[model samples]
Target chain A: MLYREAGQFKTSYAADQAIFPLAQDRIGMAIILAVAFIAIPAVANEYWLQTIMIPFLILSLAALGLNVLTGYAGQLSLGTGGFMAVGAFAAYKFATAFPEMNIIVVFLISGLISAAVGIVFGVPSLRIKGFYLAVATLAAQFFLLWLLVKYPWFYNYDPSGVISAPPIDIFGFAIDTAVSKYMLTLIIVSVLALATKNLVRSHIGRGWMAIRDMDIAAEIIGFRPLTTKLSAFAVSSFLVGVAGAMYAFLYLGSVEAAAFDITTSFNILFMVIVGGLGSVLGSFIGAAFILTLPIFLDNFPRMLGFEISVETVTHLQFMIFGALIIFFLIVEPHGLARLWTITKEKLRAWPFPY
Target chain B: MAFFLEVLTGGLLTGVLYSLVALGFVLIFKASGVFNFAQGAMVLFAALFFVGFIDLGVPVVLSAILTIAVMILLAYLIERLVLSHLVNQEAISLFMATIGISYFLDGFGQTIWGSDIRRLDIGLPQDAFVFGASVLGDDIFVNELDVVAAVVAGALVAVLAVFFSKTKIGRALRAVADDHQAAMSVGIPLRSIWMIVWAVAGIVGLVAGIMWGAKLGVQFSLSLVALKALPVLILGGFTSVPGAIVGGLMIGAGEKLAEVYLGPVIGGAIEDWFAYMLAMIFLLFRPQGLFGEKIIERI
Candidate 1:
């Protein structure tokens, strides 16, 4: 009854084409945003803000980036971690070189750097398709990591090859606290995520979806394959790069090139796939699921009063997480977004067998 | 000159092991069209099981046989639990599923066999074979393990070639690879063929695991070697057995030469990404791989 949109009426094309066309969806989204912006910030402790919310947001952004290409554009990339490394390293360089510049500017420049790298790697998509293309991306993943590690210049010649984000200030407001960092991440993520929604709704997004569905058909229909594919790569990598900067600057603070390894790439791809490929909200859901699962797993045994070693917990987490990935794929390859929609449908038809 | 020979020989031998792993990938991909990302995990699992069995006091030969049996059981389990349920899905979906399988196998292998890097001394010598100094005024050398690995890889390729051409099941697998619907139409049980293919791939992974594990120690990196096989697969065609062989040798040799000659200039450690970079550049000119057929897309 609560989810029913039967009485909802749209008088104009703009109204009908609105992101949340249904009144119920609009209300639901408003409530979620309210809680996220107000309730959580007011109540969530430092640990939750720094450890959980910040990571969830950053990873969701990364997942959104991957979703753009792999989910929306049908380009299966394994170079996400490498691109992220580019972003992180670029940001590090920017922040150190121009210490007086705005942190926001640093993030944007880094993202652009990553976008350039992404396009270079994406050039292979013109020549290669499917599995062959996927393998080509692996070169990006490895080569970038090697570049970051081999060159000490990226890390500001730190003897340990590890770099830390310098203190960032916006208009004399030092964003060093967990709450401030969380707020910064939230603002960046929301603005970019909104832009993503708009982008996906535009003809460009349709072009990507067309390519995803059938590149040959998309090409026949007057879309340039190189431009469409590279644009997807550029936009996706830009978001991922920003997320990488946030991950290093806001979340981890101190990090090394090793932080963004092949595992990180696989993890982001999993988030995109498990979150739902083409759904915007699915990115957040998938990120939250993958990121939080490990923490929950680590704490569950102890909370139940059983003393378990950290090693055992980690091992169990991998096994369970792996099984869960398989389970989700088999049960609903469309991911949690599809499940959410299904539940909404059920809610609308409540108290009926159908 | 002798030093050049040593580096070349080393690369060739290392390339053989890479080919063995790539062979596992080619077999499954050829038969089922699933890009089994779990191939690396299978290598790790097989090595772990073999070593775990031996750790429990089983003889090496018996442990090897039992490990093979376990891999066969794994093949059956995967086909039943994962593959059968996922039939007729998109190639990307199938690929993602295999990645799921990879994660599971990685965790399961380590959980059962312990995650510590373990040494397997199957009495293989570790010393290098040296050519006498009188011939070239310097000793030419080859690692014994590399020599053994190369010989084993050669034999495995020969045996697989014979099996694919001569065996009935192999012919059926080839049929399935050619066209799934046509094979099914002819009453060839697709499930059985998949199982056989996976089992054979599992065995190939096992051999790769043993040789690599012996060289690097049975550790997580053994799984990463599987990633190295991807460039080899690209260089050699993913479906061509001979392609994997030559691709592996070229990659192994190319990376080594680059490392020895280009490493100092680049500050070293080019081995990690050299093969992938080569494959990426090569793909621009030849996307179907050196041997893979050029696919013509139809709307």
Candidate 2:
């Protein structure tokens, strides 16, 4: 009965269209935000903030970006890593060149640069479709990585080819500690996630869904394929780029172009797939699941009192990861988000099946 | 001119080996409509199995036969476990499933066979055969192993061509590829066709594994050749056998030429992305590729 929405009537169009129409949902979200913003920061140690929460939020942002393009627009791209590299490099250049600029502005500009590159790569999607388009995106991945690596100027002629993030000073306040960095990432991710939720609920998102379902029919219905698809790319790349900037500046502190390789792209894609396509909450859930899996695998054997070799554990990690992907796809192809929805539905109908 | 000829010959030889890998991809795609991203992993697995058996004191011939049996078994397991369950799923899901398979094979293969790079010696000559040394007072050489690879690839292609044309099972495979419902209605067993195709693809992977393993030691990175084969598929068309061979040759020669002639100006190492760029540009003009059938969409 706690989950029932029986008396929540929509008195107006605004109320009907509210993101959380139910009182229970609003309360649920408030509790979650309260936990993330207050409780965790107060109780959790530096290790949890640094190792788990920070990276999880950054990668969740990346997965959300991919979800917008591949999940929402039905455009499968393998070029996410390249776009992320663009963001990281651009942020580095901006932060160093103009030290006075606000750090958040620097990330936005980096995201904009990534959006431009994404539009350029996304041009082929108009003509090519399906797996063919996916392969075409690989051109963007390989070419962008090569371009960054080949030009020493991109890294400011660093000898090691790895670029370090400049210090984060927002209005003369230092964001050096793990908690500060975690807070910074949380605010940005939460804001962006809220904005993305609104964007997808709007007409543009409807256009993307229409195109994804059937491009020909979508075209016949007067949805301009060019703008709809390209806009999706721009928005998706923007989110991903900001995430990449955070990944470099806050999480890793220093990174090379090689850090955003194809494997990274695949990991984010896995997050999108496992989390749930086209769902904002799914992105976060997926990122957490994928990120924690290896850690769980590593520690589980030790907890059982079996001393497994590191190499064997790493191999087992790969095998189990692969097997789980298949298992998830077969059992629940829609992903963990669908399972969550099912649970909520059951809760609403608890103790009475008929 | 002599140096150019040497580079061209070397690239062409490498292209032939690439075609060997791409051929396996074509076999599965044509028969089962699943883009087997795991083909490269399958290659590495076969090579690892072959070498692992030899390390166990089995003779070379016996090891080869054992690897073939294992590949066939792999084909059956993949069909029964993965493909059968995903009968009418979207193409993207199937592709992702293959990626999962690729990861499993990579970890499982390395786990069983050990991750150390082992040299594969099936007695192929490793000498450079020089050509026209006296005519121009300059030497142009080619790897003898590469020549053997070309000959072996040619023989395999010829056998496949005849088998496809003459065998009853081959016709069933084509039928299944053409229209699954029609083929099944006509009593052609869809499951067996998929298994046979996968097994045949596995055998092709074995041939490619042996050739590549002998050239470069059998190791984890051997699976990365799948990335190279992708551009070949894009150029030649995913569904065409002849397209795979022709596309492989063009990419091989094109990348080598760009690397040797254009590398210095661009700080070298352009080979990594050259084939993909070429294919991407080519796709702009012909999305269906030169040999692929035209795609017609219906609303």
What TM-score against the true fold does each predicted structure earn? 0.97, 0.98
Give the per-prediction TM-score of chain B. Answer: 0.97, 0.98
**What digit string (tens of lDDT, one per residue) describes model 1 on residues B156-245?**
999999999999987998999999999999999999999999999999999999999889999988988889999999999888999999
lDDT of 2 by residue, B1-299 (tens): 77888899899889888889999999999988898999999999999999999888999999999999999999999999988988898777787788889989998998887789999987989999886664356688999999999899989989998888899997888899899999999999999889999999999999999999999989988899988998899889988999988988898888898999998998788999999888888998899876777889999
Q: What 10-residue stretch in candidate 1 chain A is worst by lDDT?
A: A308-317
iRMS of candidate 1, one decimal?
1.1
Tens digits of per-residue lDDT, candidate 2, A1-354, equal 789788889999999999999899999999999999999889889999998999999999999999999999999988899899999989998898899999999999999999999999988888887777888888998999999899988888889777778889898999999889999999999999999999999999999999999999999999999999999999999999999889999999985888899999989999998888889999999999999998898899999999977888887888898898888878877878989999989988887846
Spell out the clash pairs found in candidate 1: none
Scored by DockQ, the top model is: 1
Docking class of 1: medium
Query: Which lDDT tens digits does candidate 1 get at residues A10-80?
Result: 89999988999988889999999899999989999999999999999999999999999988999999999
lDDT of 2 at A229: 95
How does model 2 score on DockQ?
0.75
Alpha-carbon runs more than 4 Å astray in model 2: B132-138
